[model samples]
Target: MRRLALPLAACLLLAGCAPTVSLTPAPQATAVGCASLIVGIRGIETIGDAQRRQTDAQGTAAWGTPASVTLYCGVETPEASALPCTTQSGVDWLLSESGDERIATTYGRAPGVQLITTRDASVNDALETLSGAVATSTRGTDRRCLADPGASATPSAIP
Candidate 1:
């Protein structure tokens, strides 16, 4: 009994130290192109000082011990909206804020990617680092940020 109790306690201790992150998978995560996109994102080793944590959901990823950042791929592509859009590493992202969280969604890409992070996190740095994979994996569309000069509209007409 003593030998069994010692090993059981050690196992419990090891389990407590294991890193895990809980995240909700995107609704369209099983869409045709999403698997490839997830593969690209999973290739990312780290974000800032946040290392990857094991997540239970498919097409979802979380970084940091307490999950400072999370990504969900294969959400519905967003239509034109008033949301501020910015281009990072050749990918257009629509940005929004909800209290303490900052959200960025890939614009003009089929089977969109959404990123959620704490407001204090280095979102720009994470976007920059993740952009390469997103650009390579996702399918692009004709949609462009209205502020982009190259977008097919007269310069004077842009707000």
Candidate 2:
């Protein structure tokens, strides 16, 4: 019994110290307008225990067993050169590809919000929930991903 007790206590101690996710810190500036935006927003899917610890990243939310979907708030606004924007739920998102993950960011908002999710994950649900939060956070601008003439404004799922 004594031998088992020692191992059991150690396991419990280490379990509490384990980190849920490893997040890469993103570049941040004075995020005065969007600092508190994360609090008002909630996850659309089954993502739980959302947390962000990056120095400049204002906020981050994660979901799934291995964290398939991650959202970062207070990211630096994307440059004009990054094109191919998609409008989802009234917000225009600039899409970028990184390996098997799709990164989407709001086009015109200062201190933009970023979403990093697996290719298989559904960003539409998340964007739906975040649109209002982002709209209220920053001032509007005219920059957007150019839409093809007569093309549907709605963008397909990330894949």
Best by TM-score: 1
Reference-based lDDT, each prediction: 0.77, 0.64
Q: What C-alpha RMSD separates each model from the true structure?
A: 6.3, 6.0
Candidate 1: regions farther than 4 A off: 1-16, 149-159
Off by over 4 Å in 2: 1-19, 42-58, 149-157
TM-score of 1: 0.79
Write one digit per residue (lDDT tens) for candidate 1, span 23-130: 777898887667887787766868988877778788888887688888888887667877767787888888777788878898899779988888545677678878
Q: Show the colliding residue pairs in model 1.
A: none
Each candidate structure's TM-score, on Cα atoms with residue i matched to residue i, is 0.79, 0.68
* lDDT for 157 (candidate 2): 38
